[model samples]
Target chain A: MSHGDTIPLHPSSQSDIDEIENLINASVHQSVPSARPPSPPRASIPVSVSAPSPSPFVPSNLPKSSSSAVPPPPPPPTGFGPAPNTLTEPVWDTVKRDLSRIVSNLKLVVFPNPYREDPGKALRDWDLWGPFFFIVFLGLTLSWSASVKKSEVFAVAFALLAAGAVILTLNVLLLGGHIIFFQSLSLLGYCLFPLDVGALICMLKDNVIVKVVVVCVTLAWSSWAAYPFMSSAVNPRRKALALYPVFLMYVSVGFLIIAID
Target chain B: MDPNQPEVENYANPKTCFFHVLFKASALAFYILSALFIDNFVIIFVVTVLLAALDFWVVKNVSGRILVGLRWWNEINDLGESVWKFECLDHESLARMNKKDSWLFWWTLYITAVAWIVLAIFSLIRLQADYLLVVGVCLTLSIANIVGFTKCKKDAKKQIQQFASQTIASRFSSTLQSAFSVV
Candidate 1:
């Protein structure tokens, strides 16, 4: 009886609500309804005793799982377990490698194409961490610089960068050109680093002429960084149609940076 | 069909589409008839342009988006670059727009422009230089919307077409991949 009382404890904790209701139905399966509460611990008690006599033997699972738990988890951990343990490299090594990859990708994207190779081919591995940082940073700076509507500014700047990257990619694609989606997104986000710099500088400089000149240079820089990738992606005939929006989005960010201050 | 739930019927909502047509018609009517009633050009200009501007704002910002699932704007930067901005709802939402609404929105747009152009010609034949300026301003506003929306519609349709082709291509490629695997 003591063993029967404890039997319901483990399974009641682990089993889902459906199983508990099923156990209740079994306990109350008789025509005469009992006044007992429909809790799991009490409900499962009747299931085990009648389990041996009746074919509706759900308590059979209860004892089997308990015994299974008593046995040490399969000895396969020693044989194949080494693989799982060894699968994970030292944590520091992973962090270092991912960090380096992000940096190099940022470099490849933000800087002018250094090699004569195709930008698409060279960017075999891409991480959105750099883009995410740049966008959030731009949003934060734009929000920080705003005299009013701070949260709204952050939201608009963030959404513009995120959606603009996708729309620009789609624009190029619809114009009948090939480009990888995330890589283009990464490139666009990295391009924001220039505007990110422009925003930061605008935040520091109090003068309007200084802000305007900084925004102009940075806007041109961003457009320049993105120009090769975008222009190359579309057919030469409709290249302006595709590139104009990219220029416009960057110009918008620049304007936001100037306007917010 | 439940009379309480009129939207369940297999038809487009007429109420909103009627208003869409009404706004454009009223704007045109007021601009033309204002010259007859009001002797003052400034009052006519203010009222006529006000109506035209109101229609432009409604069609550009409100009706275009709601009725046809498209919007457009042109922003000229300080550097003198004319940047055309466009917005179009995804294919699903565009499909969900009322057929009558789309029809009414577009027909009214073109017909209104034609009406204004006819007015412009009448002003030209009469050689009423002052009224011609009003027509020109109103004509320019209406045509700007037409061009913007036309380009936006083209972009949206092309996007949906591209999406369809890509989906078919992807499914075809997947089928090929599975066939090779089975082999």
Candidate 2:
């Protein structure tokens, strides 16, 4: 029977025609045509009936049998993107690891690399919590020793954070540094490490000489620590300019802690 | 892949997110209120320590892993030496990590650490030996979380280096073999 005549007789849907064509194509391509003769319905159908319009039966988009045998599945996704590890671990495990890293950072064995492209990785290594907490504790201790009120202590802390944010923002906007805001904050926060120690020492020692020595040492430490980071973050020509804000930031934090009454 | 557990994407669901923030914030708020409003220092110390421990647990297991896909644990080997194990989200997964969850994790982590250290220093100045004990525990817990993730970062670096080296080595060996066969 002609293909068009069979379409009305068997009620074969377009999908069925497509599947039959695929089977015939597969058999022909596999060199096993006699194994399953192309269904009479498909062979008799004209290319036009199954080609353009889907009128209950037909298939289009034929593959070149010689080369396109079994089209490959769609390529798997590519590129290394930021993806969280799929590890579902208990919390205690993470705590232990964090403790070890805290000690390592405190020993100054590893510094957070502000140059890291991944903000998360750089911030993670910086252990901002350890240094930030230590600095806050020391800052509060200094304020308390000086008999500063709690409200004043809050004011100073907020002012320091706000100032650091402003300086870092300015660096990003004007200097064109690609520093992530939080990562920059983390780096600047660590710059206070020396001042924290200085505060602690000045608190313990009543001698004017010791306090002065500690202040000088801390100023140098904070400046030196910040110089490398700030320089690398900004344009080479603008390194010196970038360092100015960091220098100012550190000095202000120290001044806030010491000058508060 | 249990139907019950949250899908990878849903791990950062609003409910978990809410609980995560609530637990950590409430722990600190409760401790501060107890320390400030409560008259009995003994009660204050006990409550604060307990609350801090609770926060430590919550941050470590819940927010730490779910929010950032990082976790760690301490184990003692046969020799009684302590060994640390860290797990972190793969980079591909990290790429899909929720930004808000990360923001909450890092900020809260930094603030929590600072709070504990401040309390610890306060106790030291006041010469309150009992309060120091609590401070010590809280500090240790906080440090553990930070240290675990730092080491995880290091491990990831090491793994990448190793994989690169292996690939290069295999390519070199294959090249040598092919050249020899050609000869």
Candidate 3:
């Protein structure tokens, strides 16, 4: 008979429909009942035997009927299992679920960019090189402020020379034989002997006074060294390291002041 | 959420403000006392250093405690929310998870309170007599802060439980609807 022409079963003759409805009603009744009476001993035996029969019957459909059939062949173990396209749909669904979860949990607010990890780059961006150089020059000019008494001038000159030497040493150590070495050395000479010939400036300077001069000069030099660290590009670790010299100068001054007192 | 973002609106806890004010008052007292009565430079310097050391300790301790408190508060808040979410997702699991989180929150809060009380007593003993008035003010403020925090904690707990129950009901309804649709 054609599919549409099939006769509908009468209620009296529909044993399958009756069985299904009875089964469903029994399930609903069992679910509603809180206390379930224990099954009779013989009734449990059939249930226990039937439970595993379906699973065993599924494997029996395979061709092998011998003892060797106990070891099932691995699914295409020699070849690449599946293409990306085959798994993509399920993976995409999982990703979509996770993304949706993240979206729901996240606050939809945007904030300004936070502080940079490096600060030295900021200093560089501001072009503070001129100020740094001016500070060095200012330190040298301080000597000119002193009265031209033979001893006072000598002390000032000595201090300037000491400062210059310290700067030169730092530049050399930090830059390591770069072309800037000669330029720094020349700047050092100009700082130490501004008006007079270089040899005579050094010959008459007292060693004790020169040491004091060196301390002041070293302080100025270290301050200049720290200027580059003010840049936003400078990493905190490097900035911290660069700050050590300035700290050392402060400590040294503290000791000197204490000794003098 | 970006993990780097700082979650708390204020880094300094209200409780910390009290300690800071006390420390500052003590510092001012120390300075005035040294200037008026203690003329010896060495003695003044030593006293200053000692006071500074004590101040540092107070700030460090208070800051540490506040940070711990803030972290725990956040955890509890988050846990409360999570419990609610879990309940909505699966009511069968809610009882177990809720009990675990409640126990954890209570334990952390209790331990923190005990630690704070110990620290408070220690601070009271260590602080100078001239600045005892400031310390008393700090203690009063701290007590107020504790009371406020307790109220907030209790409210949060109740709100979270209610939120979870509501969520579960809604989710359960939706699940039933979908099951009915398929059937």
Candidate 4:
């Protein structure tokens, strides 16, 4: 028989009608069970799993009422969001954010709080590109200030990169290679901020007094930016030890800028 | 919805779009051209200063507010202590912020600073110390904008934290009132 013709809509007799009515009433009773017995064990599993998960931070003593009258608790406040990273973000955004971080680092505004698990944010925040770019830029500028020829300009640029690499290597050896290579490079790179500023000031006037003041001020500023970062990177007991090398590193950078001519 | 979540409002702001490109282009062009070819200290100084001033104005008033939906200012209180005030666009507005505008504004800002530094070096090489003053002015302006904007961002985070606590308090009281009335 065809599908539609296979089933009968009406009950054939009074007994059939009574059986159907009883089946309908039984389902209604099962659904509205507050006035009846508890739900069967098999039926309760899905219901429990479907509930919204409560926060682990919430205290156990708090009311657990899931009734309509009780409102849910608000979400907890979060600290700063993750830094912009290279993978998901557009190239321009990542570059811009990194540049901003350099400025912030120079101003002693914020440090790049990198999580080991998220390489994207870490790499974006501490990318070596920034240091390299600024190094070249500053190298070119400093070379110009010193009246260096085009041939010697290359040497100055290479020297800046070499100095950065030396510090990166020293940091890695000191930390037992526990840190990312780029992180070390970034730290070294940002430390160059003061030297970069001092380089400009030195170019401003040929006076010995101004040069002394600029070098001194920049040394202090770069140290201020690098010390906290170095201290945090190493063990508390060895904080001073790690910071010592960082100081020498910045000092060397300052001396290099001063000796550029 | 969590009350702590930033409330964002998005709408058409042509002023934001206009000033973002205008200020960035003008500032950059002026910086590069003035240092490279102008040579005359007076012309270079006036152009650089005027452009820097325009950039400061545009960033503080227009691009900062419209593009990123953040604005900030420092005011001296009655006791003469400086107080920083920061305002951020609601969540909707921030969500709708054009990525292009923000990228342009920031990149130009940093580039301008770098350019000025390069110019200072060029001036020194040319044995002209006077141009250093112009370079210094431009540097201060760009650095100020960078610091102000970043500080504003930090303040917004604090505001979010405060909003979250307030929401929790209000929610707890509302639930308590309902629970007691039910008895």
Higher DockQ: candidate 2 or 4? 2
Q: Cα miss at B104, model 1 (Å)?
A: 57
Model 1's A-chain: what TM-score? 0.65
Model 1 bad stretches (over 4 Å) = A1-87, B1-183
Candidate 2, position B60, lDDT? 64
Error of 3 at B73 (Å): 17
Over A1-261, each residue of candidate 1 has an lDDT whose tens digit, in order, gives 122223332243333322333333343344112322232211111111111111121222221211111211111101110122211234345457657978887676567763445544434455566776788788878877987766566656766787789999888878887666766787888888889999999888889999999999999888877877777667789889988999999998888899895
Cα deviation in Å at residue A175, candidate 2? 1.2
What tens-digit string does per-residue lDDT give for candidate 4 at B17-95? 5665576567667767766776544445455566676677667656776565566654323332334556564332343
Report the number of the highest-lDDT candidate. 1
What lDDT tens digits, residue by residue, belong to model 2 across residues B45-109?
A: 44555566556666666776677656664433333233455555443344345655665666666
Would you list the C-alpha lDDT of every candidate in the order shown? 0.61, 0.52, 0.32, 0.51
Error of 4 at B113 (Å): 3.0
- List chain B TM-scores, each candidate: 0.84, 0.73, 0.34, 0.75
Worst 10 residues of 3 chain B by lDDT: B82-91
DockQ measured for candidate 1 = 0.01
Q: Write the per-residue lDDT of candidate 4 for residues A4-116, one digit (tens) a residue.
A: 32222233444333333343334323432342233221111111101122222121211211111122221111221222212223334534754676665444313334333
lDDT of 3 by residue, B1-183 (tens): 233422332323445454544554454466557657874433343344344434343332332223222111111121111111100111111111222222322333344334435544654687633233223333433443444334433332343344334333443454555558669
Give the Å error, residue A245, model 3.
18
lDDT of 1: 0.61
Fnat for each model? 0.00, 0.06, 0.00, 0.00
